[model samples]
Target: MAENLATASYNRRHDLLQRLRTDGRLDVSAIAEEVGISRETLRRDLRKLESQGLLRRSYGVAYPVESGAYESELSARVDSNVEEKMRIATAAISHLGAAQNVFIDEGFTTQLIAQHLPESEHFTVITPSLPIAALHWA
Candidate 1:
């Protein structure tokens, strides 16, 4: 019985790692449901994976460590947690009180921040990404 349980656990972890690699990120609840396991069980499995440097979990999402040269495309990242990103962006703008210049990084979340920036504010925005620069222009 113990051996069977161990095997089951091993299989679950393997499945999760595989999914994370393919998907780039996994929503915790969605993965738990797909694997037919409780959220708590999945979390435990994720914890093990994190300890092994196989993945990282944040805000109910599991992201795989880059084992190869593979990286998730920006469009895929932009589509994930869009609502949460918008909320974060809205909150982030509040911190820019009376700043004359702002530097935005190259990431989907930063792009949302650029979108949420108040049009009334006359700050000079600087970014290396063309998409973010275009937002300021528009």
Candidate 2:
């Protein structure tokens, strides 16, 4: 019984994070219905996510802390599937050409490219994100 309840809680939290990742933000009513849990229970989950620095609660809504153009939180995006991102970045770099201009977006996957980008004077990189700019400059 105790173990079952703990497993249920773990599943709920995992689902909650997945929902946030897919939707960028969540409303108390919507998430409660989606998770098939009471509002109070959902609030407890939100509180836990907040404590983990994954999200922010405002009024009846919870928004990811790493909100960007895609509405996903930066920290959450970077921390999720790190190895996959690295693999993707490596694949993308293989297609790069010398003496060409490139524009990278601010998405999580694109940020990996910025991190793994080779040091080259031949390619010009343009990005609007300060963090990516810093990465390139560094």
Candidate 3:
């Protein structure tokens, strides 16, 4: 039951994020009108999204993070390939093998892959993208 609730909350947040991608802002009344949720509910959802690092909000504004605020250049590139990046990230993780030092390109997509890396699967990654490095450490 808890998992289901989490999933529902996640779905709501994901949908809201996608909307922000296209619209640049999440108006409470508009969100209620479009999503069929009450403004209060949408406000709660937005608050959760803000806390989760999915977005930043103030007063009545929300914008997709850009450049350094988002993924690194490598992560951005990898995100572009979607399936291929996923496959590569998944496969490359197997090569980690307790290695302490790593290198990554200055690409956002590549850096995004590193962000998702497991904490227990320890490795030090060297990357050209500051965002990726921050993501790894974050």
Candidate 4:
């Protein structure tokens, strides 16, 4: 009986992952109903998946985590959305007002923002990313 219960739990979690992959996201209450489980049980399964880095849960929805190995590479991300990222970078810089110091987060878009910042003696840019620091250092 214990073994059967364990198998059932494993099967249910696997099915939940498959559904999240196919649909891109799962509605918590709806999925619980469809899978014949309580919402609490589904929530527990979602939490487990989140802890495993297989999925992320937000509000009442769960989304499968896309493989980050390729997509997260700086070279790949920098080439993917040049125009949109540039526009965002420009907009972000425009809102700086009279700030003498700026903190840029580590990401491709933030890198673009660093590139777009005007050459000014009064501005001091701070970033934790090595690439961004190297770009500005020279």
Candidate achieving the largest lDDT: 1
lDDT of 2 by residue, 1-138 (tens): 999998787668767877887898899998798768999999998898788787889999888875332234577577888899889999998888663887888878898887877875456779987788787465
Q: Which residue segments of model 3 deviate by more than 4 Å?
A: 66-138
Candidate 4, pairs of clashing residues? none
Maximum-TM-score candidate: 4
Judging by lDDT, tell me the better candidate of 2 and 3.
2
Candidate 1, residue 36: lDDT: 92
Sort by lDDT, best first: what order?
1, 4, 2, 3
Q: Is candidate 1 or candidate 4 better by lDDT?
A: 1
State the number of backbone clashes in model 3. 17
- Regions of model 1 farther than 4 Å from truth: 1-70
Compared with the true structure, all predictions reach lDDT values of: 0.87, 0.80, 0.71, 0.84
In candidate 4, position 135 carries an lDDT of 78
Tell me model 3's lDDT, rounded to 2 decimals.
0.71
lDDT per residue for candidate 3 within 1-138, as digits (tens), equals: 999988777678778887888888777676788898887877888888777677777766676653333332342354466877677777877777777887877654465568667888677778777777677475
Report the lDDT tens digits of candidate 1 across residue range 31-128: 88888999999999999989888898899999989664333468758787989998899889999999989999888999989888888889898899
Give all TM-scores, in the order shown. 0.51, 0.51, 0.46, 0.53
Model 1 TM-score, all chains together: 0.51
> Which one wins by lDDT: 3 or 4?
4
- Candidate ranking (TM-score, best to worst): 4, 1, 2, 3
Q: Is candidate 2 or candidate 3 better by TM-score?
A: 2
